[model samples]
Target: MKQDTPTPLQEADDSGFAVRVTQSAKSVAAKVLPVSSGATALLFGVVMFLVTFGMVMVFAASSVDSVRSEQNILSVVFRQGLFTFFGIPLMLIAARVKEGFYRRVAVWGVLLGIALQCLVFTPLGDEYGGNRNWIRFGDFVSIQPSEFVKLALAVWIGFVLSRKGGRVREFIPAWIPVAPVAILAIGLVMLGRDFGTVVIMVALVFGAMFIAGVKIRHLLAPLIVVSVVAVPIVLSSPSRVRRIQHFFDGCTEAEYYAGCWQQLHGTWAMSGGGVLGVGLGNSRAKWNWLPEADSDYIFAIIAEELGMIGAITVLLLYAVMTYAFIRIIREAQSPFTKIVTGAVMVWIVGQAFVNIAVVLGLLPVLGVPLPLVSAGGSQTLATLLAIGVVLALARSDRQSSQDGEAPEDVRLAVRAEGRA
Candidate 1:
């Protein structure tokens, strides 16, 4: 016996609604993001290339110091190689991690890092180069908690802003808890008298806040207030006050030697490079003429060795990397990815510029490392790990591509931005 056919209206009144809803949900789930493996490959290649170049330059710049200290030409190079060996693989592992996993782990990661920073007060922390920020497990291994603090602060700010939503700007003292935490962190470093790391952390906080949509008025208020308050901090330190004096006075008098020595030599090194540079690994500055040749003054060494063309090329590469990162943050599907990548980009490039500016005598020295190019293991690893997170975001982005339609939530959010 044949059953009677159901009418369109009957079906609509029955299972049509449920069926359509199920199909739509499935469709939305299918189109999570547009992941691009090719972009990931490109990013990895570029990062590795830059890192390798830095390793080579580290050897070139540190050779003289190494020979004088240890009589081993490979001393600094081997140490840098060790950092690369460990850091590169960790970066790769971080790149494969999922977004949700990162979010979940951020709080714990930051908390652990903060705990480590507190250890600076203990006997484990070693004072070096006038900064007591270094924590030594042994003579062979040491970690700079400030390096990890950068990531911690970025993650913490991203989390706080993400949770607070639009009310992040309001003065509820909801951010009050973070104040003590930040003070403790900054205070500990300041106790060590490591102004460079403090500057970096300051930049990282401001960068994260800006990208996470903190109001410009809100940001500028504290910044101005801080500047006003900081006048005493700068004046209180004899070394810092003297450096500032020399910066304005110009490096003319021989008596300014102690204060202006690094800047003066750095400028001479850069000037000596002229156009085509002396040659890679042929820097006269690295021959003990410039202090911190492989660290703060590496750029001057590059200018001396590679000349204007090389210096400009390195600058342009950094510019390209910055542009790429900005593109990644802008195109990111989630606020978490956007804020994280933006913070890291600012930290790396901003620090690089600060280091360069100090060497060029355009700014007072803060002793920040030149990101991937610097000789510090902690900084090299931290920077690479941060970039790797960006690569993971890029990977996840390319994976969610499906049909032409995206989720209603994504579509709605994009529209909201326009309206806002």
Candidate 2:
């Protein structure tokens, strides 16, 4: 063996062979491990990009309306930008807070939301588009308080359900603690006559419970009860009933000039964009043809000006964002982090889908603004704050991982993959 010692050429070949094997093993491992480690950075990047993209889209969609109504073409964009400024800092602050701090204050947050929502019934409350949900802070300034309630409900539900812990499998144990407060939140929003928000709030409650591992039967019971109660409420309103009736008509002539006006125009906007949009700021809908161009139906304008590709890109971004939230949920070590992150995922992303479906006539118009992309300060601020909470959860989860106590789910996943 000593006499047959390998030459430099043999040594080089052996080293290269080891390198090839290592690379091959890594490739195989990469294929086996489909999920990333929480992907916190990806979540933040997607959110920031959406916020910036929303400002740009709002500018494009609101230019005509701003010039027509405000006499200043930049007025709407400037207002939204100001909200962006305010929301970003709140988001950063939220990201720095401890998760346990939110848990301890959930009840107070719900009370605050309820108090603000009560203002909708006060003298300062102003009616807009038939929904008496706005409170004016000044002659030109107003806010929709239900927007804040959306996040508050999520936090409260998580705190209450997580308190149940091992007993969460029992319906009464989980349902009784949060039921009264949940009812009060829903009732206050109902008093404002904003059914769109009511639907979202209902979903938000169920989402928190579901994510916290509450009994499914308990979750389903309330969902069914709410649906049953909502039917007559929908049919009782003549305007809502008309919208429902026209929803199935496919925007025909008889209904087009009446209830389906926005529906038809929104459809036309999407069709005009084709595979690639007409080009940014080139949408005809913003010229007064499609209503709520910068709010509920902004998705239509995005499709119209940017085309199908643009629409797909927006959807892909959301999909990625959703995945990141799910990853956080899976990697989270504490019940609070998992519950809050899941609740936020449902709030912002679920609302976006509903808004898009309404614009495309796939669903009856719900009047909910597109999250992050809509030109409303309240929705934008609340949503950014929610994301901040999510980032906070992510920070904690990452720190926990670095300390070698990986979340149980993640550790199990790694162990299983390693065996392969």
Best by lDDT: 2
| Span of 10 residues, lowest total lDDT, candidate 1 | 29-38
TM-score for predicted model 1 compared with the true structure: 0.85
With candidate 1 superimposed using the best TM-score fit, by how many Å does residue 280's alpha carbon deviate from the native?
1.7
- Candidate 1 residue-wise lDDT, 55-119, digit = tens: 98899899999999899989998999999999988887777777666777877887888788888
Question: Pairs clashing in candidate 2?
Answer: 276-307, 277-306, 277-307
TM-score of each: 0.85, 0.86
- Candidate 2, residue 396: how far the Cα is off, in Å: 2.3
lDDT tens digits by residue: candidate 2, 179-245: 8888898888887778888888887778878888887787888889888989988887788888888
lDDT value for model 1: 0.77
Query: Relative to the true structure, how large is the alpha-carbon lDDT of every model?
Result: 0.77, 0.84
